[model samples]
Every structure is written in C-alpha cells, then in structure tokens.
Target: MNEIGGWRLSKKLGSGGNGIVRLAQKGEQKGAMKILRYDSPKARNRFHDEVMSMRLCADIPGVLPVLESQVDPDEPGQKWFVMGLVKLLTDQLSDRSGLRTVVQAFAAYAETLAAMHQLKVSHRDIKPDNLFFYDGGWAVGDFGLATFQGKKAVTGGGRKIGPIYYLAPEMLNDPGNADERCADVFSLAKSLWVIATGQHYPLPGSYDLDHSAFRIGSYLSGERGVIELDRLIASATAFEPSRRPSMKLVGEELRAWLAPNVEISMPTNIDFKEHIAAIEQWQHSRARAAKSQKVRDEAIRSLTNRLSDYLNSPLSNLKNLIEKSLGITTTINKNPKCGFLELRVEVPADQDRLAFIILILDLNCESFPAVNLQGRIILEWRNKAGFINLIWKRCYEFIENGADEPIKIDTLRAEMTEATLKALSETLSLIIPSHKIEHKPKLVRIKVHDEKGDMLSGVSLRFIDSEGITLAAAKTANGIVEVALPTLKNVVIFVAHGSFNSTVVTLPDENLLVVLNGDPRSRSMICGGSWVSLAGLKGELAFVHDEIEGGIHRLYVHLKELSGNSGAPGAVDLSIGKPVRLKDNAGRVAYMTPRAVIGDNYLIDFEHAGDL
Candidate 1:
C-alpha cells in the first residue's frame, strides 16, 4: 500500500498472525503502527481488542500508551492502530546473573498486572512474547483472549483462550467457571520460570491436550540452572487449582525469592569447537610463515628496540611481558597454606625481548584447570596510542614436556613459580591504559570512626578520580582525621581496615559521616531493620533508583517508630490521603503526613495529616 489514511508506510519491522507492524510517520506524529490483515475478521477483532486493552492500561506505570487508531479507508476490512514503540527485551535469562534487570522489569510488570486486576481486567494471554519492555514498565499485547467479568470472551464461543504453556489447569477444564484472576497468576509465575531457565516451555512437546501435571512438574523441577525459580514455578503450576496462590501473593513471593540470590554465569552462544579449530589453524599458519620468512638485522634490532621501550615505561609490571618474566616464576613445591606470596627480582630495562616460562602446579590432582594469567602479573610499560594495552602471553604445554623422568614436586614448583612470575611481570609492562578525560576536583569531606567512639588511627585511604587516577596514603591524623577531596563528578572513595575494605561515597554538599556502632563479625543488625547497616554499603547508595526494594512503599510498617503516627501497621490503610501517625521504636510519635510524589514514585511526606 502506498499510503494509509494520511501516513506513509516506511518499513516492516515484524509481523504476527493478526497484522504486520510497520514504522510509520505522519506529520509531527511518529510511532509504530500495526495494521490488521484485511481478509480475516478475527484479526481485525483482535486488533480492536488490543487497542482497547492497552488504552485501558495507559494509566498503569509499565503499560505503553495507545496513541490513536481507526479502520483503514484504503483497504476494506482492515484496521490500523498506532502506539509508542519500545525496545524489545529478548531471551536473556542466562545473561542476567545478578537479577538486577530482571528484578526491576518484573517489579514493573507485577505492578502493572496488579493495577489491571484491580480494575477488573484479565490479560488471558500472558507469555514472554506478549510482554514488551518499555521505559517505565512492560507493555502487554495480544488481548484477543482478554475477557471482562460480565462480557463474553472472543475465543471458544466465550469459552477458554490462552497460551497452552501458561494456562492454569482449572482454566482448561472449567473454562467459564474458573477465575480469570487465578489464571493470570499462574501465567505470571510460568512467565517468570521461562525468564529464569531460558526454556521454551515446561515440557518438550506440542500443546498436548492430555498433559499430566505430575509429568510436567517432574520435568520442570528437574531442569538445570536457577533451581530456586524452577521450584517456585513448579509449585505455582500445580494441577490442583486450589493449591495455587493468588497473583498478588505470587508476585510477593517471587520478589522475596530474588532478593538474596544473584546469578553470575549467563548463557553464551559462542561456538567453542569452532573457536578451537580457528586457533589451531592460526598456529599452523604462523609457524609456517616464521620458518619461511627472511629476516634482516635491522628488523631484529627494531623488534628488540620496541621491547626495550616497553620495559622502560612507567606502568605496572603486570601489564608488560618482558619486565614481568624477569621478576616472577611459577613454583611447584610451594607453601600450600600461603594465602598470598610475593617474590622480588631485578630486570634489565634495556633488553630487546626475553621470553619467560610460567608453570602452574595444580594442587587438586582430580582435574587440570586452565589458569587465567591475564592480570595475575604486572609490568611497567608506556604507549603512544593514547591507551595502555597488556602485553600478555601464555602457552599450554605438559609439565614435563617430553622428558621421560617423573618430576619432583619441589623442583617443578620452584621452576614453575619462577617462570610464571617473570612472564606475568613482562606482560604487565606491555599493557596500554584506556583513553581517559581528567577533570579538576572541587572538594568534599569524609569522616570515619571505630565502634568504641575512638578515632581509628593510621588508617589507609585511597582516592580515585573520575579520570581513573588513584592516590593512596596512610592516615596521618590519629582517630579523628579530615580529608579534603577534590570535587570531581563520579569519583569513588575506598576505605580499608586490617583485612576488610569499605567504600564510602562523597556527594557534593552532603556531609559523609560513618559511625561503626556494632560488632564487626555480626551480619544481623543490632537495631531494627528500619535501615540497612551503613558498614556494608559499597558506594551503591549514591545512585539509588526510585523503584528499588527500599523505596517508599505503602506497607504495614510500625509507623509509631517514625514519630508522629502511632498505630498498628494494619490499623489504617496507607494511601494518598489517609490520616495516620508514626511511632519510633521508643514509642514516641513521629511525623504525621499525607503521601506525595517525590520523584517518579509516590511516598509519604512528613506533616500533620490534618490540623492537630
């Protein structure tokens, strides 16, 4: 079609069963437009349903806004709807190890679902594909299956409609009689399971009508990775509908489950077999080239001179290859109990290039693990390329090479350690630092003290500038000391004691006071859990988002501990205009106030709710 209504069709981005989504621009309005297939009545009806559904959810935080829509005049039987486009969040369940993105996205989705349920709406088709990640929250689509309380559904003669993977057992069997709310809950939990495991579904077959719940649960529960999520979803997808929890309860449980655990390893699609083959091929080509090449004395001298330049640079030895090899070695028969070890050696800064051997003696005889020697050694080096690059080298060879004698532990250990240390140091010297921009600091002040209220004496503090410069010096001031910090944007401050290190942040105009009040060994708080202990805070508090876990939520907390309001957590419903008092832990009334929007989210601001 050349044009629809007044807008010109740009290009097709994606398509579905009902319509093809196209990027469209009309006058000053720009958005993604979905056009229904002209021949299918079902598709047009589905498009209308989605338009109305998203329009109703526009007020919700995560749902996207439906800008406009109308029937296509050029093409009879076709309808078109325009809405804001959002970035698609693909299958990344494995990559999200720390659960930061997943948790934040899920929280917004949960809030949107809760808001929908409260408005007497049911999103029947709840699947990962239907969930569109947007700025504020997820935008749910495909509402052809949506059904209101007194209205007839568009599917199965107002019967049952939902993705088979997420459909509740009761919904499939009872259809009209089953509560749509519970079905949404089951779907949400099932969706979370997919996000956790990166699996296509609970089991491997087409939508089999005669599926057994026990079989499905057994399969899902036994899946590898994200064991916690697997078990939670397994429980939610129980055959007995009565056994399943409510959607709100499921959301709460999921939130709690994700709080403590952080996943580290994510799934990678890199082909290891192909990579190995390429490495082997490269080695063959390089060996052949080296054997056939005619080298001149000048070329040799140039290479040696470059190596000399690297050795004489003022960077870490670990970053240089030549300097690192000269200083460190890998030892086999070494002190096993040593938490850390250091060796001092001399290196000739004028050497052209020297190859150092590093040997790793694996104590655990069960398996041979590849040692990551990337940053283990440092060398001093300088480069003119405006950045530092690590001069790194490693070789995989048998401990005894081709020797026919069994190696002694002590001898092999000494040799390996010697070689490894030297090689690492040389590598360090070759490294080139990344490009950076340095800014002059303004000024900030930081304070620190010990539990006895005594000033901690002789503490070592390191200041990191925004341009990646780090300066460290011992605290000359006794227990009480003040450090004048340059006012640099996005700089970090690190504080360290005996074996423990803490990061305290310095914000412009905000005074930084750290008072160590409890036993260092205690993980649990000595006071109530009103505030997270300030000791373990690692510069994370400086940039807290509005929707973080510790945000101002309308929960049943003892407001009496706060000061003005003294009442049970559940005594009054905490809302926008609700009058409530807070009491501190010592039974003193805290500030009484109505809620207000602080940033993007709403929180209770302190004031007398009304005239005292």
Candidate 2:
C-alpha cells in the first residue's frame, strides 16, 4: 500500500469524471479519496472547486463531506481530497426491493437536495451510483458536474456534462445556459424513480408500461394515502423547466408520506439493505434516449411467482379486507404470464333465487393509459331463472383525477365497498317472482378502423338503446370486438375513445370505419341556427398573440383579418388578446379558446381569465 498525505491507499473503488476513487485507511480510519488525474492548471483549479463545494455542504446530513485535501497546486504532484466512506445505495437495494426501503432513501435524498437548492448548489449528475446509504441515512455524492452561484462556466461546445440517463433535456440541448436548480429537480426525480423501480430508466411522461401489479404505487396502495408519485415524477421530469415543482415542495410532499397514518408496512422479511454488495463502476455518459423496447421484453412476471409472497403485499391485504367485510369469498383465477388484472367476484344470493351480483375489474394492456384504469361498478344480470343479479359497478376510473395516478388502495377499496352495497340494494328493488328462461347469448363481431382505413384497436365501443340506455359495452381488440345486441328493442352502436368524439353507427353496420373526414363540428355549428358569425369575412384568418399593455390579460387572443394568409399586407385588426364569448341569445352558451393554430401563426393558448 502506498501512503499519500499520511493515508495508505488500499483497493481501487471506482473512477469519477475528475479522477480515480480509492479506499484510503489512516490509523484505523477509512475513507474515499479522489485523486486528480491531469496536472494542468485548469484541472487543478477545477478539482479545488469540487473540494470547496463539498466543504460548503460539510455538516448537511445527506451530503458526503470533504475531510482533508491537498489544495495547494504549486507543491502537489496530484490534487486529492478525502471524503467519508459510504456504501452505495444500489448495493443496499435492488430490482426486487420493497417500496418502504425506497421511501426511506427518498426522504433523505429530498431533504438533502432541498438544502442544496437553498444554498444554490446543484448536484446535476444524479444516478444510482452516486447515491450512498451511510450514517443512518442516504447521501448524494459526486459533485463533478455541480454548479453553484457565481461559478465560472467552462462548458465545451457540443458536449453534455451531466449523467446521460438522468440529465434533463434542457441540459443536453444547452448545458451552459440551462438552469442548474431545475436540472437538479429533474435528475433527482429521475434518480428516485430508478431507485424505487429497479428499471434502467424512466419512461417518457407518465405512461408507465410496467405491470400495475408490480409498480411502486401498487406495492403501497392498500389502505394508504394517495402518494401520486407517478404524477409527481411526471411533473418534475416535464420537458419544460417552468412546469417542474420547486425542490422545497418536492421535499414537503415526500416527507408527507412518512407520516404515521400513511406508513406502508414492509411486506416481507427480506431486508433489501442486508443484501450483498455489488459495487458497479460508474460511467460518465451513454445514449440520451433509453431503449424502452428492452423494458417491454421484461414485462409482467408470472402469477405463480406471486403464489407465496404476493399474499403479503398491500394489494393482497386489500383483497382480503374486501372479502372479509362483504362476507363473500371471491373466486379469482390468474395466468402468470398475462398482464391483465381481471377479477370476478360472486355475490350473495337473494331469497327464492331472485337476485345475484357479479363484481368485476378488467385491466387489460390495450385499453390502458388512454382511459387509464377503467372498470364497471354496476350491471343488471339477465339470467333465465328470473334471478335478478345486481352488479355493483359503474364506470369508475382510478386515474381520472390525475392521468398518472395509480389505483390507490383506499380509493379502490372505498369505491368497491360502496359499489357492492349499492348493487345489492338495486338487486333487491328489481327482484320479482318470474319464470326461469335461459337462451343462447349473441355476440356481433364488429371491426373498427380509422379515417385512413387502418385498423383501430383499443377503442371503447358502447351499444345503446334509443333512450340512450347502455345495453352492452366492450373494447375492440385487434381492430374487432364482439358485442351482444338486443333481439326485441332497436339499438344503436357508438364508440367513445377516452374524451374524443365517437364514431356512431346503427345496427347492420358491422364493418365500422372511423371516417372523421368532413368537419362535422362546422356542420353542427351551421345547423345550430343561432350562433356568432365573423364580422366582414376576409382572405386570411390569423390568430396571434397580443403583447400590448402587458397583453391586456393573458387569455386575450388578437385576431387579425389579413389580406393574404402567407405574405402579409397590413393586418386588419379584429379582436385584441381578451377572452370573448359569442352569445346566441341563449345566455352562457358558447365560448372560444384557441385549441391549436395552423400555418406560421403566433398563436396564444390560454384558459378562462378576464371574460368579455
């Protein structure tokens, strides 16, 4: 072992951007020392800056501290600084770890980052390797890419200086000019998602392709408050910096989950922290975009894997609670290889065989995300035994409140319990003495296609009566779905995909093509008879922003009637950037807000503000 500054260097730990890290022991004390590689003045000064930055955060709980350092450049062969040794967080937890462990790590990471942001220091390069679990808490390490207030920028052109997987888009595009604090927020949020989910990288936006059964929220949902972590993560990792929440707010929300009522119990005896150490060598960069296809390959695990420990999971607790409270034993079957969370429950029977109920929740892969998580709450069972089965289910979505919110356990349980009771009550009311009659069911296979004649899958289609009473509903798979139609009464078929306008058709149109060719909206406006028409229609309609007098309120869209749509003559002014509603003499009937603009128009998008 070679001695440097009275410390004997032991095993090589890893390499960092600035230098090589090694385990150094001096008089029974061990720590990590990063030795500067290049001897240039710029390199020495940069290393000195790193040392000073750590020193600034010396006493912070979750920050790795700089202890002894050889800062004098004139008398040193190589610059080096010793930091207190810490075990990597990745070494403690892994792909199959419990969420409680992640929350434990997150609370520390959040608190530390909040403090750093307060001091104007940003740990821009955040990833699994740089995070450490030590001193009874988690700490963020490696400030190689950190930038503090008044720090001189020396970014090379066309070179990105942050961790490749976690770096914000803004940093990758313009690293020198990007906001450090905002970059820290994105990277930290990404890092947390990676730690919670043992995935290589986070998916874009809130569209998590992970199985609902194994997601972080799924692990903690049962009887717990809404963590809304998916939404939170999405907001922080938004492409725009203005959309990200402040680090302080992030810390507050994370710390809120640590409260007593919301504490999620550890479901297993396997403590992730006690696992064997697998120290990985850190890399400076890789491709910016992660291979999301690889994630698809590692999709849902078999249900047999859940035959044992899954009973201890939070979701299992919820299932047991529902069954016990209802005095009903739910008969459920699962195929381990399938990605759907389909459950069918048999309810209590009525006197004289007059009633029955079935509770079902269908979470298939195709119809997911667009509608998020959808399930029915109530249905009337039509059995020939004159037995009225009341299904306690209506169209309720667990994620309607927030697109990214997972099925929170408390919410799911409450809805289910209410649905079961309501369904029972409905069944009793509809019960009557009648003869038993059973007939073969009917299913009409209808294929759906888009305007261009391409097959459209996952579109939710509803079969209805003339009175707008829904008879049956189903989603199209492989561009086709079989829906049962009524034999006696006349019915119509319609498809409503999420919130978009549906492709409506009556019976006999089995091959449905989604032809949104003509502007039906325009036709509807014309047929309304009473509406607002443009004053003095001209050659070109230009919808642009109005920056006059501080924009005269944000919702103001300045409309101009130009001589030509492209090459502009003097713009003939129509309206200023102000909210305007066109009255049809039917009070509070119509309003206009720019949805999207065509051509090279300076469009201003706004919500309800100052009304005119």
Candidate 3:
C-alpha cells in the first residue's frame, strides 16, 4: 500500500492516457483515487475542469462526487482526486438481464444526465465505462472532456473528442461549436443502445433498429412517448443538433416510459360503468389531441401565406386608406428587416423611411413570433401600439392554452384588418398639423348625406384638430350632427360608416354636407360587401356570398338589385384565393377584395369578406 494524504492506495482499478485510478482507503472510508501521470498543460487543464465540474454536481444524487482533490491542477507532483468506489456500468444490461431492468436503469440514468444538464454541464465523454452503479444509484464519473456551457473551450477546436462509437456526429464534424448538451444526449442514447444490446459499441452512424438486442423494450414511447418517447429518442438522435431534445425533456421522456396512459389495473378495480366511462374519456382525449394536431398542422402550413396576406390585405389597405382618406402619401417597404417580416409605412412628408407605422411581424414567429405567439394576440407594434385603444384583441382564433403547445403562426388577414386600420388612423393623426386650421370651436351643424344628396342616418362623425386627433364624435339621427367648433380656419371631419370611413376637410361656419361613397350598413366594419351606387349605375350593386356548403371551396355569390332596379338576383361563383370581381347583367361592376384567412386549414367563406 502507498500512503498519501493519509489515504492508502491499494489495487490499480484502471488506467487512461494521462491518469491512473487506484483503490484507496482511509480507515473506514474507501474510495477510488485518480492520479495524473503527466505534467502537460492539457493534462493540467483537464484535471482542473474535472475537479471544478465534480464540485458543482456534488449534491446531485446521481452524479459522482469528489471527496478531496488537488484543486490547483498546476500543483507539483501527482494531481489526484478520490471518488466513491463503484462498479463499471459495462455489461449491466447483459443478454440475460431483462429489458425491464435495462429500461429502469437507463431511465434513471437519463434523469441523472438531466440533472447535469440543468447545471449546464455536459459530461462530453459519457460511455458505459464512465458510468458506474453505487449507493443504490448510478453515478457518471470522469470529467476530462466535460464542458461548462457558454464557457471558453479548453480543448482546441475541429477535432473529434469522445469515444468514436458513442460520439455525436456534430462532435465528430464540428466539435468546437457543437451544442455540448445535445451532443451529450446523443452519446448517452447511443450508450443505452450499446448496453441494452450488450454490444461493445454501436456501429458509428447506424440506427438502433438496424442492430439487434430485443431493442423493442428500449423502443418505449407514449405522451412523452406518443410512441412519443420513441419519436423523442428519434429526434434526440437526429443528425441535426437542433433536432435533439434538451436533457430535461429527455429525462421527462425516460420517466414517462414507466407511466401507463391508463393503468391496466384500473378496469379491474373500478365498477363496470366507471370502466366504460374511463375508456370513453380516454378515447375522446386521444381523438381531441389528433384533431387539434390536424388543425395545428394546417395552420402552420398557412403561416408563410398568412404573412403575404398581411402585406396584401390590411397593410395594403392601410397605405391606400391613409393616402386617399387621411391625405398622407405613403409607401410600404415590403422587404424583411432583420430576417423578420416588417411592414414599415413611410410617408412622403419626410421623403425618408420615417416609419410612420412599423409592424414587424415575425416571418418566422417562433423565430419572429406574433402576439407573443399564444393566448393573447398581442402587438409589440412599434411605439405606436398604445395610440389605438381598441386595436388589440385576444387570438382565441389561433392559440388555445387549455393544456399547452408551442405557439404557431395561425393568424389571418381578416383577423388583423380592423385593428391595423384603426392603428394606422390613430398613428397617422400624430403627424397632422398638416390640416393647419387654427381657430376656436363654435356651434356647427354637419349634415351627412350619401353621394346622391339623400340624407344618411346612423353616420358616425368625428371632429378633428389640425394636429389630427379626434376631439369629439357624434352620430346622426336627423341627417344633422351638431358639434361646437371655431369657424375662422378650415376644419377636418372624419365620417365613419360600418364599411366606409372617410376624412373630410370643411369650414365650421357653414353647415357642411358630407358625402360618404359606400353603404352605411355594411356587414363588415372594414370593407363594403354592402350595397353601393356607382356614378353610372342606378341600382345599388353588391353580392351576397354563401357559406361553404359541402367540401366546396369556391365563394358562392348572389348579386341582387335590393331596391328593385330589377333583373333576377345574379348568382355567380368565384374561387377562394383570387380577388373577387362580380359584373351585373347591366355591365355594372361590384369588386370585392377578400380578407379571409386562406390556407391549408381552410379556404375562407365570404359572410363578412371584401370591400367595394
């Protein structure tokens, strides 16, 4: 026996390139001491990393602990650390050892690795020989290549670091930049395959299924498995590092292997009726999950187009409406800013991209998410989000967090249209001393009428200042809406109808006659699918689009002369995505631009679609 630090070293346990492990005993305590055999800088750094890493994981039940060590790796003579003596995990899952035992053991090992990962440590050199069973729990030992995430790499880049067979492809290909935690997950899973099959090691780049070992028990999967565990493992072992699950998720998945969705014993214990009810509930839950998954898949598929829909619809309307109604000439720079779908509205006022309204919707929302991607359809719309009081609303149409799922890009053009217009209006107002009307307010009567000189009822009117903010709003019942204002300079009034909103510049002293072009009773607040009388056309023209009746995707439209200018109602059909253009028999036109959320999930219906 050789004595050092009052501990007597006995039998040699193992030997590595730079160190040797020996059984050590100090009175009643027994441990394994690893002594450095070289004085190179690499060896010294390796020891330092090992000691520091072991110190961090000392309290975790599954990780091996260092009792005492030469903390300073540069110390003279032998650098050694003593750890609890445990048996190597090699051959623990021998052919005779049931797959049950292999599953139970590896599942716990997964938990241990998870604990290490939670601490941001990756035992980069994990292998069956590095794992040991002691104190009725498994402990992973050896931190020569262990990595502290986000820290400077101790070893040089571009070289394979771990054992060849258990090495993650990324570690083999790009060791320096490879995500250490994900690499560890790969190595651990590969090690599981090796042990479960009782093979010396797995064939590099080969799948577990390709090899044999009653590996089906290891194929364990469900909620975490869905055969889900199997899928998770598949993903964890995916060639791409990004595809792998985090250690925490892998650990949860491993534990889930032991849980049954419905215990087999439940039917035996519960009464017949209860058993039947349980089966029905279970079946319903599964069906619901499948249905939800289908909906989610369809929505995700629409994400790219939804992004385009935004640009073509609300954002397009915003630019046009601002120029026509608010008198602010603007342009939309449709290019992505920062790899994100950015809708930046610039006004001619500055002749530069002043960002009059910037809505940077995440093109890849999970990468560039929308409304926080879940429960609420939130808008972090440039600093102007707060100006429109009612612009923000819940995205119940997309995200449903009964349980939880990753947020998907499922927003529609119709869903965001009204909000976008209101926000644009409010935001544009901030730039308005353009109306330069400097006068005190006095009593004035604003008479509302359609383009035909017919008195228009139910027209909502707003009195705005030179600064472009609404000072007051009044709805008309007798064709006249009265408000007090000054008559010295010109006044700007906003006329609002359900589907039509216009900005009018007038003098407060004279009783102003405001002409609204579109119908006041539009079904949609954002557009006029409602009736409209064109300059040359006598009958009010529009279309009534029916909801989809079977699996049909085309829009079903019925053109009618509601006031009896009289031909029969013209029934026409249009495709789902293209803009709708309906021509009455008299050569009169009723054009409707669709605002439906069209995608893989559904081709939208026209109950409340389009503008005149």
The TM-score measured for candidate 3 stands at: 0.46
Query: RMSD to native for every prediction?
Result: 23.2, 22.7, 22.0
Give the 10-residue window scoring lowest on summed lDDT in candidate 3: 379-388
Which numbered prediction scores highest in lDDT against the true structure?
A: 3
Give the Å error, residue 467, model 3.
Answer: 16
Task: For model 1, give the RMSD to the true fold.
Answer: 23.2
List model 2 lDDT by residue over 372-470, tens digit each. 222333222222211111123223322212322232434555576566556555443333313332334455677766566766567665565433355
Report the C-alpha displacement of residue 576, candidate 1, in angstroms: 29
**Candidate 3 per-residue C-alpha lDDT over 1-612 given as tens digits, one digit per residue, 9 for 90 to 100:** 397778899999998866888999999999999888888777777777787888887877788888888747556766788988887775344556654566567777778878877676788897888888887877788887888743333777777888787888888867766777888888887777666545666656634322223233333221122232333444457676755656665565556555545646553564454244334334434533443556545555565555455445656776677678757555555445322344444433222213244444433233111113311111111111111111233232111121112212334445455555655655444333346645555677788776778886777665654333446668888678888765434234545554443433333445677776543223222212455443333355443433233322233444555222233556554422222444444554444433221111111112111122
| Off by more than 4 A, model 3 | 91-97, 149-153, 206-229, 264-612
Local distance difference test scores for all models: 0.44, 0.52, 0.54
Q: Give the lDDT ranking, best first.
A: 3, 2, 1
Q: Which of 1 and 3 is the better model by TM-score?
A: 3
How many pairs collide in each candidate, listed in order? 84, 11, 14
Superior candidate under TM-score, 1 versus 2 = 2
lDDT of 1 by residue, 257-347 (tens): 4454454575985545334433433443343333222432333344334423432232233325434543343232222221112222233
- Candidate with the greatest TM-score versus the true structure: 3
